[model samples]
Target: MSDTVVIRRSGQAGPTSEVVDISIPSDQVFERLVRDGAVAVARWLGFSEERLADMQLAVSEAVNNAIEHGNKNDAHSRVGVRFIVRNDRLAVQVVDQGTGLAASQLTEGRPSIQNKLDNGEESPRGLGIYLIEQLVDDVELQSDEQGHSFIMWFNLTTQGKEGVDEHHD
Candidate 1:
């Protein structure tokens, strides 16, 4: 149920980066894979414990949405995850095979769950997307003929050795 997935790119001059891809059939595996990627990326970025936990949670929710909603628990379809580390930030992309959402709707924050419930709606989604936006610097959702993808960017400047001096001085 658990595995260490590592992604690597060539021809980079600075700190090395990695991307781990996993195809998970079940919710349990999906959650674990995301957590593993988050841990790996956070460690690679030299993030503090708190930041690592945040990253893990954010990625976990993203993957869950891909599995539960996008793929609809279809075991045949696979979710693609890519993690990239650049000079100043870390980027994670989760792609799922499903009908995409309306881009405009996502851009304009949708009504919250409380609002929907107060209005007498039975169910509501998108709470995770809202949280992802708050947790990371950037979040983008895109879909084409192939599948739907959620791309998230976290600034390394907020964590680890590079930003530690800011607190001290």
Candidate 2:
């Protein structure tokens, strides 16, 4: 499926709530499109270059996980992304059509190379969730038998003249 994008604005004035909805086929080739769409919205909302890069990586990783892991790279499946734009923050939700992930899989722990080696794991992978959690201000993951939703938020109000702090509230 080709990319389908919808933008809705609640008001024409300053900092009104806006929404950008995008759906694409479960193909890695379309991952960049999703990332670009998110960055475009973030940029328009006055995100700093540093924060823009962070948002780009986090959004790309989420879409990649949705396409590769959730949909199992099935072209027929579709990944949906919804960006909610507000004055103080930007909230994004990426959904995929696949069997849900276990609750244990969505922990806040970051995998380490030493731990992987000690456990004799085949690969030192599974860092997407960790990266997303670190880059974004907040993250909440939900999944069931139907599908999985990776939702994250970024703070926009704090980064004024003082610049962004290390607060991930």
Candidate 3:
């Protein structure tokens, strides 16, 4: 179960993937749909209740960010979320049709929300990213002319290797 899940998305380079793509209007109401559905799938795939919560929180943050920040709360714009689950890992991505996150934040390692507040960064930017970073095993960010994507990975094995961090409180 240490193997990585290969997900091949359009314009995304990776191995062949079994992707679950859900696109919704840029309204915040749609966030719950994606978060709940992903948690249900993760549970059906044998993840424990604890794991379900982790996925739920991370997905919630990503979806909220997509709708609020990335899509600028535009109901007409769309937010795309793709879930990929394999034997070894589960990867969730939230893509928005808006300007991406800053590249500098992507390079910083394990940035905490407190750091942002101390540094006087804008509200919730550091907080949301910090929460997602702490919840998942790994997070990947991509920025392009189209929009930004927040791709998060959850490991599914028990070899002490990273699958998911169930607790970040």
lDDT of each: 0.70, 0.79, 0.72
Model 3 over residues 88-139: C-alpha lDDT tens digits? 7888888888874545555345556686678876663456677777778899
**Segments of candidate 1 deviating more than 4 angstroms:** 1-17, 102-113, 116-123, 160-169
Query: Which lDDT tens digits does candidate 2 get at residues 36-149?
Result: 887798778888767877888999999998988899998888898988867788889999888956345466477787977899877556688778877888888889877999
State the lDDT of candidate 1 residue by residue for 1-169, as single tens digits.
Answer: 2233334444444554544455555355656856886797688678887677767878887888887878787766666677777667788888888776735435446547786768877656667766677677788888787778888888877863223332334
Candidate structures ordered by TM-score, highest first: 2, 1, 3
The TM-scores, one per candidate, come to: 0.75, 0.80, 0.72
Clash count (model 3, backbone only):
1
Instruction: State how far residue 92 of model 3 sits from its true place (Å).
Output: 0.5
Name the top TM-score candidate. Answer: 2
Clashing pairs in 1: 7-18, 7-19
| lDDT order of candidates, top first | 2, 3, 1
- Winner by lDDT: 2
Error of 3 at 107 (Å): 6.5
Runs in model 2 deviating more than 4 A are: 1-14, 115-122, 160-169
Error of 1 at 103 (Å): 2.5
